[model samples]
Target: MPTLVLDTLVNAPIAIVFDLARSIDLHMYSTKKTNERAIAGITSGLIELGQTVRWRAKHLGVYQTLTVRITKMEKPYFFEDKMIQGVFQSMDHQHLFEEQEDGAILMRDVFHFRAPLGPLGRFAEWSFLTVYMKRFLEERNRIIKAVAESGDYVCYC
Candidate 1:
């Protein structure tokens, strides 16, 4: 398994950042490069605990679909989503939000994933998947931070 952690500071309220992170529309917008979409489950609006979303996207020149469920949530503080079915052997992503002393929102993302194929998979993870996924998450967070700070997140709701 490969684990990735990312932190971003947004000059916005924690609630706005949290809601933007879970907004299906915002996710789609953030991943426009991958042409991602929520095709099933909660296709739009904020995703709540116990809810699931099926995402269809083009990654690494291949089209794929992955289903994930919100396994845990704590309002504007934290939320976790785990993969129910995907190309990966397993995947879990946690989103956390904290209000800083400066009143800005600090957003953190922890992502863990394992690919298939045993040793080959481990090699892939260490070699390329890890870096690739890190960039993917960074790009997504950049969009979230921008949207939240600019108050454009409301347009996605």
Candidate 2:
């Protein structure tokens, strides 16, 4: 398994940042380059606990569908989503939010995933999947930060 952790600072409230992070609309906007979209289950608004979302997207020149369920949520502080069905053997993403003294939010993402095909999968992770996934998460966080800081979260939240 490979784990990727990222911390993004946003000059916004924790609640707003949390909502935008779980917003389907905001996700679509952030991943437009990959043509990612919520095709089923909580497809439009904020995803809640136990809710499953099926996403269809193009990655690495291939189209793939992945289903994830929000397994845990604690309002504006923390949330966890896990893959129910996807190309990966297993995937877990934890989103954590902390409020700063100045009213800003420190959003953290911890992603852990294992690829299939045993040794071949290990090679993939060591070669490019890790970098690709890191870039993907970074881009998503970038958009979330931009939207939260700009007060544009009203549209999605």
Candidate 3:
């Protein structure tokens, strides 16, 4: 398994950033370049703990579908989602938020995923998947930060 971690500072309230992170609508907006969509389960609105969401998207020039369940949550502080079914052997993404004294939020993402096919998968991770996934997460976080900072994230939730 390869893990990717990212930390970002957003000029927004912790609650706003947290909600935007879980908003299905904001996800779709962020992934517009990939044409990602929630096709099953919670198709819109904020995803709560224990809920499953099925997403279809085009990545690496291939159309893929992945299902994930929100396994843990702690209001505006933290949340974890795990893959139920997807291209990876296993996938887990944890989102954490901390409020700064300046009233902004420090957001962090910890993502872990294991590809299939044994050695080949490890090679892929080393050669490309790791970098690709990092960029993917960065892009998503960029959108989240932008939206949350703009104070319009409430409209998506």
Candidate 1, pairs of clashing residues: none
Model 2 lDDT at residue 2? 97
Q: Write the per-residue lDDT of candidate 1 for residues 28-138, one digit (tens) a residue.
A: 999999999999999999999999999999999999999999999999999999999999999999999999999988899999999999999999999899999999999
Better of 2 and 3 by TM-score: 2
Better of 2 and 3 by lDDT: 2
lDDT of 2 by residue, 7-124 (tens): 9999988889999999999999999999999999999999999999999999999999999999999999999999999999999999999988877789999999998999999999
After superposing candidate 3, which stretches have Cα over 4 Å from the reference?
Answer: none
Q: Pick out the ten consecutive residues of candidate 2 with the lowest summed lDDT.
A: 98-107
Candidate 3 structure quality by residue, lDDT tens digits, 1-157: 8999899999987888999999999999999989999999999999999999999999999999999999999998999999999999899999999988888799999999999999999999999999999999999999999988787787897
Each model's C-alpha lDDT? 0.94, 0.96, 0.94
Task: Mark the regions of model 2 whose C-alpha exceeds 4 Å error after superposition.
Answer: none
lDDT of 3: 0.94
Off by over 4 Å in 1: none
Model 1 steric clash total: 0
